[model samples]
Target chain A: NAGVTQTPKFRVLKTGQSMTLLCAQDMNHEYMYWYRQDPGMGLRLIHYSVGEGTTAKGEVPDGYNVSRLKKQNFLLGLESAAPSQTSVYFCASSYWRGGPESTDTQYFGPGTRLTVL
Target chain B: AQSVAQPEDQVNVAEGNPLTVKCTYSVSGNPYLFWYVQYPNRGLQFLLKYITGDNLVKGSYGFEAEFNKSQTSFHLKKPSALVSDSALYFCAVRDDILTGGGNKLTFGTGTQLKVEL
Candidate 1:
């Protein structure tokens, strides 16, 4: 299984430019999430989807929007890029079930490094 | 709100020596703790997790973590470290809001482990 994979391993954008990130998982996970990693700051949640066609705002959702049209894919969009938005973005997915057997361990992708100038 | 803390910015250890990575968490209810490692410019990889029973949870790459409920801590340990094990380690806790769906995770800043030869 390829597990989770992300597109555009590296990107550089001018301020106010727009772009979208693609995330896909082959594990048939029910939950998908996007996070940003910065130096000295842990990975912060950006947005997540419980299932296909469902999306929810996470801890750091501003300047970012997400769409989960298909179960295997989640897309994160930047309407207008900003310097503060430059960071390494990661996508994670997990198969979660209720009860004791569920460890809720998330599997992450390689990550996309974005730079805003 | 759920949160995790990795107090150390970096930890150095001689190869073949024991290694420890500290982690503390704060949450309202049961805390589902997890450990992930990230290689340079790579994504985070799941190491181990603590869900229900067994305070000592073993995971991939001969790594293990001790879950201390009283201290609200889950520290990762390796009996004998290897130079290849050097990477950035992150501790995370599942958000308690598992009501509707989406098992979101809160991650720590990260601890850089340096295993010297």
Candidate 2:
């Protein structure tokens, strides 16, 4: 199983352009997340879905949008690319149980490098 | 709100020497902690997690972390460092909020570990 895979490994967008980074998982996970990694900024969650047709805002979700139309895919979209949005995007999937004690390890995709000019 | 901190931005160690990367977390109760590694241009890989049971959790690549409840720390350690182990390491904790039952994770800024010969 390709635990998780992301499309468009690298992309360059002009300011005000739009794009979407696609993430897919075959692990049958119930949780999927989108994160951006910047130098010294670590990984900040942008959006997440607990299940198909369910989505939620995360720590840094202001500049992005997401959808989980299918159980295996999560899409992160940038309506208008900006220099500040230029960063490495990562997609992760994991199983989720109802309690705090259920520590499910998240599996990540290779990541997409986005450059906004 | 939940948070994680990787105190060091970078850590250096000899190839045959022991190594340690510190992490501290803050959560309401029963924090679910995790460690992940990232090679250059790659996605984060799950290393270890501490939920319950033994405080010492061993994980991939001979890495281990001790969960100290008193100090709210989960420091990663390895008996002998390998040059291949040079990578970026991250610490994360699950959100303590129980409203959504979505087990969201908050990550540290990351620490770069350099193992030299």
Choose the strongest candidate by TM-score.
2
Cα-based lDDT at residue B37, candidate 1: 98
lDDT of 2 at B98: 69
Instruction: For candidate 2, write residues A1-117 as lDDT tens digits.
Output: 888999999999999999999999999999999999999999998989999999999889987999999999999999999999999999999997655567688899999999999
Q: What CAPRI class is candidate 2?
A: high
**How well does model 1 score by local distance difference test?**
0.93
**Candidate 1 per-residue C-alpha lDDT over B1-117 given as tens digits, one digit per residue, 9 for 90 to 100:** 778999999999999999999999998888889999999988999998888888999999999999998998999999999999999999998878554347788899999999999
Backbone clashes for every candidate come to 0, 0
lDDT of 2 by residue, B1-117 (tens): 778999999999999999999999988777889999999999999999988899999999999999999999999999999999999999998887564557778899999999999
CA RMSD, predictions in order = 1.4, 1.0
Per residue, candidate 1 scores C-alpha lDDT tens digits across A25-105 of 999998999999999998999999989999999889999999999999999999999999999999999987865446577
